[model samples]
Target: MLLRQLEYLVALARERHFARAAEACHVSQPALSEGLRKLEDELKVLLVRRGRAYEGLTPEGERIVRRAQRLLADRDALREEATALRTGLSGTLRIGSVPTASGAVSLLTDPFCAAHPLASVQLRTDLRAEEVLRRVRDFEIDAGITYTPDSTEGVRTHPLYEERYVLLTGASEEPAAHPNVTRPNATRPNATWAEAAELPLCLLEPGMQGRRTLDEVFTGLGLAPRPRVETDSVASLFAHVRTGRWASVVPYAWLHVFGVPPGMRALPLVGPVHGAPIVLVLADRRPGPVMARALLEVARRTDAATVLERLP
Candidate 1:
């Protein structure tokens, strides 16, 4: 019935614990419980089904929680905009990103920070494309960076870059690393999909979006890469490849940021260049949040793909 009630509900849904939700709402357990009761009575519906401890929300509660999240986001955005008119934007700007694109999130956040000194940025790097979209829909994050999503119904997308994959391997024996790659020509340093498959590789978990794309490339070429290590962390992939015994297929952005790690080689994987378009996704709400709009503007003006043309 009240915004305070809605806040309590959203916090409960997020924390899934009565005491924690109360703590998040900055109120005592009794006050939060009383507010929820009044909200339920006014709506004449059982929002949460409880049994001593905190039980999950009811079906109706689930629907209301979604709407509550949006309403709260709008309320906060309204306040932010009014404040911005006088003092500039203040509040956290949340952005979610897929792991591969995580290294490059700075491409967006750096500029946003420079423009809005009163705001802070929270960059969540563990999201998958689905989770990013989901969080955006639920207003958990202001925007997302991911490979061009398959569906773009209620969201707006700005293409940041086309992700290019590269093979990261140790340079311990490079001038003649493989019979195929005698030396990496700076202008056209390349290795074929088949050549990459032949190496002892370390890769992301199969469940990851980037790993799936890599699998498709190998499958298309009639080659299957058997990685010696599998991890969810990109840093782990780089570390394994650093051992000289394992090679990895990673986004060229990593090379752009850290530059071939030391004693390593980053060769553009060709013979089939699989490129994925990474983008910024914002919810398509009417009069979207001011911070999100500003971020989208920054993204549109950015040449996020420019680094690919001139990287190690």
Candidate 2:
């Protein structure tokens, strides 16, 4: 069967609509339908569940779609290999990163681009830890930056750094001269988890690894924190904390990389000291992709101490 037919099949499975899939493949609906029909005839098995509207793929069709995805990924890998042999290593490197590690991703990407000037890099920062691993396994992303837990099997991980948590809040300004005035100590050097939980706080959503770690720590300490606001974006958390009325627990490196916004202050978390080991993950394929290998080289040479020191 033609590779084009396989492309049409995969697109149809993804879109789950005949017209949308045709649009995605840049072909007419009738042409796409004819292509799939021809493919089924060649294979001697019905691929699509035909109806007035678009019915789902048949059981065999589902199996073929999975195989087709792998075939397309292998084709792309072959093309990348050919290009590398002709010139130097050059192609788009897709990286998925968890929200807390998003700011620190530049530490790896910056040096990687400098070493391979012709290579392009795409960084997806809002992925959850599970999503990052899922994308890597599915060939959707070349690598990812996420927390290094104990369950990484069939995946290679490179430890980058340990992320320490901190409390972010607005900077306390001096109160004007008045007979009755009280100012809170917003610039405290450190705060306990219990203390931070008492404030109206904004935090990352529960699905995120960063938020999960914080939740576990709080739970272990016999504290239950009900956040005033929950969001998926770390930038949004910072925005809320900047209002002086809200606070959040975030990574120390986040404050260093993004800087304390004009009226914000970052305080170290006290009491139960905790940190998560951030790592770079790639599928454990024999002779992995050239771009992923190049990124691993950069990670190997990166000095975690130096990276932390360079942070603002």
Cα RMSD, each candidate? 2.8, 3.7
Evaluated at residue 239, the lDDT of candidate 2 is 84
What lDDT is obtained when candidate 1 is compared to the true structure?
0.86
Expressed as tens digits, the lDDT of each residue in 246-291 for candidate 2 is 7789888786577778887777788977888899999777688788
Please identify model 1 stretches exceeding 4 Å from their true place.
174-188
**Per-model CA lDDT versus the true structure:** 0.86, 0.84
**For residues 124-165, what per-residue lDDT tens digits would candidate 1 score against the true structure?**
998777899988888989999998888898788888888999
lDDT of 2 at 254: 85
Q: After the best TM-score superposition of candidate 2, give how far the Cα of residue 270 lies from its true spot, in angstroms.
A: 2.5
On a 0 to 100 scale, what is the lDDT of residue 248 in model 1?
Answer: 86
Q: Which stretches of candidate 2 lie over 4 Å from their true place?
A: 50-55, 149-154, 173-188, 309-312
